[model samples]
Target: KLTAVLTYHVVAGKVMAADVRAGKVKTVQGSELTIATAGGVMVDKSKVTKTDIVADNGVIHVIDTVLMPK
Candidate 1:
């Protein structure tokens, strides 16, 4: 049900934590996500574990936890 939201958090291109901090990115769901440094390079509550998984049409980055929208 919420998979769309989670997946949308990912960028279409390979975005490392370093790259993410440079700007605000749009999600697949048309929402905008603010990337910044918290306790660490945090995306909501999840820390990006793996990055730059290339697919035929997109990319995937693994996070340590799930993100719930408020």
Candidate 2:
């Protein structure tokens, strides 16, 4: 359950802030996450607080809430 929730927050590949688009993206947990780029970038119901945190494996985008896989 915890693992599923964690992986649900991640999308495959290194997606930067500039590359983000308004659509559904497949996560590593085998679930699709809805992304909105209206006023700002939103992941599901969570607003993206931060973006483009470079990591060894991939990039990270901080969200306001934890995403749950349905």
**Pairs clashing within candidate 1:** none
Please list the residue runs of candidate 2 whose C-alpha ends up more than 4 Å from where it truly belongs after superposition.
Answer: none
The candidate maximizing TM-score is 2
- Candidate achieving the largest lDDT: 2
Compared with the true structure, the alpha-carbon lDDT of candidate 2 equals 0.90
Off by over 4 Å in 1: 1-7, 12-18, 37-40
Scanning candidate 1 in windows of ten residues, the lowest lDDT window is 14-23
lDDT string for model 1 (34-68, tens) is 66565656665567678767677766777787765
**lDDT value for model 1:** 0.64
Instruction: In angstroms, give how far residue 62 of model 2 lies from its true place.
Output: 0.5
lDDT (10s digit) by residue, model 2, range 1-70: 9999888887778899999999999989998988999999888899999989898999988889877789
